[model samples]
Target: MFDIVKQWKWYDWAMLLLRMVACISLILTFIELRDQFTLALWVVVLWELAAFSVPWLCLLLNHKAYWVTETVISGGISIYLTSIFPAAYLSFIVPAFLMAANSSGIAYRWTGPVTIVLIPLLIKLYAPSTNLILMMVHVALAFAFGFAFHLLMVNHRQNEIIRTQNTVLEQYLSQVERVTLLEERERLSKELHDTMGHTYTAVIMGLESLRSTAADAAAQHKLSDLLELTRTSLDEIRGYLHELDSPQEQLPLVQSLRQAAEEFGRNAGVKVGLRVLGDEYQISRQAKMTFYRCLQESLTNSVRHGHATRMDVLLQFELQQTRLEIQDNGRGTARIQEGFGLSAMKERASRLQGQVSIHSDSEEGTVVTCSLPRALKPADDVIKLMLVDNEPFVRDSLGMILESERDFEVVGRAEHGLDAVNMCEELQPHLILMDLEMPVMDGITATQSIKQRWPSIKVVILTTFEQKGKAVQAMRSGADGYLLKTMEPRELAEHIRIVIRGGTLMDPSISAKLFEGDASDFLEEKTVIAPLDTSAPESSPLRVLYDLTPREMEILQHLSKGMRYKSIAMKLYLSDGTVRNYASALYAKMGVRNREEAIEAANKAGLI
Candidate 1:
């Protein structure tokens, strides 16, 4: 019995349940017809069987084709049964309503109302003794029951669609979050490497410098062993720092540090006050770096060594520099002892040509103050850069090199192409120094996306891979320049400035890759002009002129007239990047490095 019922679907079970209810009404009808007997009574019995069995069998067979047929058959038989037996109207009413509810859209819409209206009228005609109002009430109740079920089914389907959409949205957000997290971890690890590596290197150098001043042979031997031990320990510490940096973990930075401070207060059961002054963007990268290191060292010392119940962190930006002070009201020592943390902080300050001062006494708690001179802002004509690299060390080293110069600002750093695009949206950097191979999204696709979204922004493909195919692809994807990572820092910086000033650059190493066949050999065989040699004449006249398109020359003419990129783009019906690209091509043809040089060379050549 259980196995047989298990095969029944929900709709089949509904048909069975309806049949069960009909049984009770059919039995009552039979009692009412017991005394009255005639040939009509036998006809009534056959009609009753058709009304009860036809729709149920149709449902059991799982045939939608029979829905209209069953509705017609059930309605006719129900009316006939009611004619001979007035109380039997309910028996037909139940099956007729069920059939109509299960019918197709057009059939069900008309059939259900028609069935309800017909039941009352048929009862009045077949059995005049039956009260019309009483039969109509029963028909109305049955229709309402079926209509309620329809509404429930419609709502269920809508909910299913919503759930499906929500699932898709959740998956998309998860992927974005995972990618963002990984990029952030890469940035933090790189910061750790720069900070700790500098500290350790300083300590090692200080020890080495003191080795010659050892008092005796025994002391000199001990110094040698101590220097070796420090070197070995530094290597192990580097390995540990690498392990601690994982994408799944979140590290506290100055931007989202409120939450970190709150957590620290809650867990440590202490009151911590943090105050930041001035806009983070206005603070130079060098200043921000020094401040962060000082903050980390001071916070740890206060909570661990001082056992402070209350601490305050304050940062203030002045005209020439920023001052950060960390103070804690804890047990004060009579004399201040310079530990590794304090020494490291002093060393970091010195590197930036800044000052560090410490004050402590028995009555007053320790106060650590660090003053750092703000890095000079890049020139009004400077290039704002975003660096994209998978390697943390590369990002750090390149970023520092750019920040060290007065003509460049490293506005943002990303470990992957996707992060680079996202950060660019926020930072609005003028140029992006992109690496080809990265996680999550690669340079080629990201360059395309960025160009499509923000055509004004420039992209330079900087990578270690020296592939001809990639160089061409990068250019096709809207990259403004392509350079090998092997280029020296000064040379790379110069190339970036050239690109920023409406010139395109291809590292001399990869320039041969741009052409096909013997062009590579021809390029190699060509005489290399030394741009940096002072002994050579500043302007050397050559017989052959560079090949430039008419359009490129027109753009160069505009540049020589002192037109900005946007104005030139509008006049020429081109995008800003496109105008820059044309101007860059003109620069190459003129054998000049930037717009100014190109114009100067062109003036001498009488070309522009």
Candidate 2:
């Protein structure tokens, strides 16, 4: 009860104080009327005591009924006191003010006028000599003050609600931006790890091979040095790969911050102190980065700009947010200019719905503070997965890579596409990592069948092939994504999650091939463009007279050869639906209704 009272606002205390004053006035009135201790006097005393007790009851119960009881008892007591003592009309003021303050809606608006009129009339009826005008004026003034206070409280509550909503919105936007940034970073990391790592390993191997072939002592010595340097470079690349991975299980924030402080102090030859307050809790990867960057920037600024020799760092983990404060005992300047480093630190913090504030003074030195909202940990809902590959080694390797992530559970495995389809029915996995050239049934055919049976099950083709035609075929056959086996294991796991989240992904190299807009790449044999004049008039009967894309022209030629839709799909390395769509567009452009009309029109044009 004491703690609840401590949490009460200023208005609550003010209302309580006002009620106490009214109760004290009633006690004094009772003392003055004690000489006539009759039934009426006893009745007045009881009424006053009930009015006093009602507000306290309302406070204890916190119910609308108690509040209504208080309001009624107080009004009745005020009216009786005013009627009997006449000069005791001052007691009416508190109840009128409380009525306006406590009530809302229709009651709030009408209570003031009713109290001002009704009380004065009752006073006039009982004590004809009482000053009714003065009583009305006092009641009106109390009501005005109470109504004004009520409006202020209402506005304050509205502002608080708006502030809470804005904070939530900012956090949501920041989370979205962080996810996008992390995905792009993962993509770049995967590219660097797979491409550069392989290239470096190959270089090292070639250098080692050359070392054995070198002739003479000097040549051998040079080869040995070159090989060593290449090895060193490869080791550095591997180190970078480790950093880029940024595994989910990282050191806690305190340990990370302590290590950073120690390293900075050792490198800069400055003394650093660290302090932590409150219990520690886990934070997101983006938040960790923000905190780290802010610390680095602050330390750098303290040494470079402030010419500081010693630094103090404080990390506080609060319920709402985690805060980091860095104070430097250095010669501070009067005005601080925000340079690129500070701007970058601010930008990074803002991206995670956090803030960084820096204060500097000549005497007080400099203090940099960063605050980030605590992120809630995601629930562990693991994705049920199955792997399908012809080779046992490939299936095992793929399973190992995917199972490293806690969110993925490899439920089953299959050596061939036929078995994959059969096991999928039994396992009912959420996703499948399938190889393209599997035995019995190909991945494209299996993907089509799975989508036909269970449209919700996502199938991603993971293979060494980067051919655009294969990727197109897989997508046409209802594969959710097409990826290369060269991708980093972690990146592959992330991509699987993306596919399950309704995203369609393709390897960057494959996407680039599709973007080239070359129709010849899709065909097994390139066809020569017909020698029809492209500058012919629109009225010309030749199909070339109508403007058509290169791909459209190729499809038109295929159609002119009396090929079926399935045959055209095979020849052009496309799906039947793709061929039909191209044919439909070609007919629309040539103003022909059907395939027979299109072929007849093409024959008359002398281009076939």
Which candidate has the highest TM-score of all? Answer: 2
Segments in model 2 whose C-alpha atoms lie over 4 Å from true places: 1-6, 37-43, 59-67, 156-191, 209-226, 239-250, 253-608
Q: By summed lDDT, which 10 consecutive residues of candidate 2 come out lowest? A: 522-531
lDDT of 2 by residue, 166-277 (tens): 5434533543464456556666866775676556655755676677787788988988888788778867866675676543226677887898788667656677899998
Candidate 1, position 21, lDDT: 70
TM-scores for the candidates: 0.32, 0.41
Report how far off residue 137 is in candidate 1 (Å).
1.7
**Deviation of model 2 at 321, angstroms:** 27
Candidate 2: global Cα-lDDT? 0.72
The RMSD (Cα, Å) of candidate 1 is 25.9
Best by lDDT: 2
Location of the lowest summed lDDT over 10 successive residues in candidate 1: 525-534
Q: For residues 1-608, what per-residue lDDT tens digits would candidate 1 score against the true structure?
A: 35456655565577577766775566466557656744465565665566566656655555463565455666666566667777767765566656545654555666666667765686688789787887777877776676666555556657855764454345335434643564466567566655665566567666766786778888889889988987787777667666755422323235534444554555455677888776543443334555655765665566565666687876666555667777888776768788876786788777565656765567567777787655434434466889999998688777755664545788899999999889978998888999999999999999999989997788999998887777767877888888988886667866775565445677766765544447543333221221222222334333123545456667867888999989998987544544655565566667788888987887776555
lDDT of each: 0.66, 0.72
Clashing pairs in 2: none
